[model samples]
Target: MSRQTSQKIAFALLTAAAVVVVVPIVLVIIYITIQGIGAINWEFLTAMPRNGMREGGILPAIVGTVVLTFGTAIVSIPLAIGAAIYLAEYARDTWLTRLIRLAIINLAGIPSVVYGLFGLGFFVLFLHLGTSLIAGSLTLGLMTLPIVISTAEEAIISVPQSFRVVSISLGGTRWQTIRHQVLPQALPGILTGIILGLERAAGETAPILFTVAAFYLPRLPRSPFDQSMALPYHLYVISTQVPGMSTEVQYGTALVLLALVLSMNVVAAILRSRFRRKRRW
Candidate 1:
């Protein structure tokens, strides 16, 4: 084949690959919307479940997922940011630092169910937190940390080295440079990481199952110490455990969960675009 023809063929293949990746996602959203749209209404969203979970709304599960996600952010963001700052700005290329990075990578690869077991044993039993909101939040936070730290460290490191040098030459202290120059510049990426981490936490079922998920609780949690129902676990229960469960309810729950995650992604994209527009570099 001529060189020009080969190039055209390669371009066509790349476009085909892109279509292959996107088609399934588009199909899934359309399928879920068709199957579940009838079940989505004000009453279904705002009221509590009734009739052995076959009727009424999933308000508690929705609230629980949101609350747990917020709590996970509280537990993870500070620690993740601190660790990322250390890794990016202060830590040297030493065996300890390498080991820490390796540990983070391994932690990210570990199965979510293992985190659930750890939360059950450590946070719930050993720490005496019980199978409550805090235990689940802690589990989800641990699960989320590796992603947040990796992205945040990358973000911090991506700031031009010259910027740091200029700040230092201006007589600014290391902490001041990081707090003002580095962090401000890196905030968009850090926020993206946080949103992605929290989005994953909000959707996971295994981590919350042993720590905080309520099997049939229809009421909203009153405090961080209380057990609550999350959408993932609820979906799992209704889809598998509940006999005679409505198909519409299952699809509706899935739709809501998908929408929640998509919403986070949309927000992340908007923030990233806005930040890029304002960026001087």
Candidate 2:
């Protein structure tokens, strides 16, 4: 085959592969919307769940999910970014950096159930937090640490080297150059990673199942140490644990959680767009 023809054939196969992957996702969204759209209601959202899932909403779970997400973000983002900054902007790309990167990747590869076990031992037993929101948040933060570090570092490294070189040529200090020029440009990507990390933390179940499991927390949490029902747990209870569960409520919880994750993703996309626009300017 001619080179151009070969290239065209490869592109065609890649496009087909993309479509194959995307088709299932599109179908899932459609199926979820159809199953859960009618269940989206103010009462369902605000009221306590009752009637074996036919009358209540997911208020406590929703609140817990949000708290866990935000709390995880608060705890993990700064530490991840600081680590990323040190690795990308300061440290030599030597054995030490390689070891750290490897360790981060390995952490991400560790099973969620193992994380749950660790959380149970440390946060629940050692820390004496019991099944509390703070315990869950700390576990979730640990869960997302690798994601935040790897992604934040990629974002930092993605900032054009030309920008750094120019700053250096202009006699800007390394720290000042990064602070004033490189970081702003990289901010959107970093934010995207942060949001994704939070989302991952929010959807987590295993680690949270051990450290933050709450049975029907009718009232919302007043503090981080308070125990609560998280969204993933709510879904599991509705879909799997609860007796005489209505399909509608189960599907509804799934849809709402899906929407929550998609909202985070959409916001990240908007931020990415604005960043690209600024780059053009």
Worst 10 residues of 1 by lDDT: 272-281
TM-score, one value per model: 0.97, 0.94
Q: Give the least accurate 10-residue stretch of model 2, judged by summed lDDT.
A: 47-56
Per residue, candidate 2 scores C-alpha lDDT tens digits across 1-281 of: 99999999999999999999999989999999899888989988887776655577888888889888888888898899999899889999799889998999999999998989998899988989888888888888988999988888898999889999999999999999999888898888788889888888888888889888686777788887889988898888777777777787788888988898889899889888988888752
Alpha carbon lDDT at 251, candidate 2 = 84
Q: Residue-wise lDDT of candidate 1 within 18-70, one digit each (tens)?
A: 99999999999999999999899999999999998999999999999999999
**Cα error of candidate 1 at position 166, Å:** 1.1
Query: What is the lDDT of every predicted structure here?
Result: 0.96, 0.86
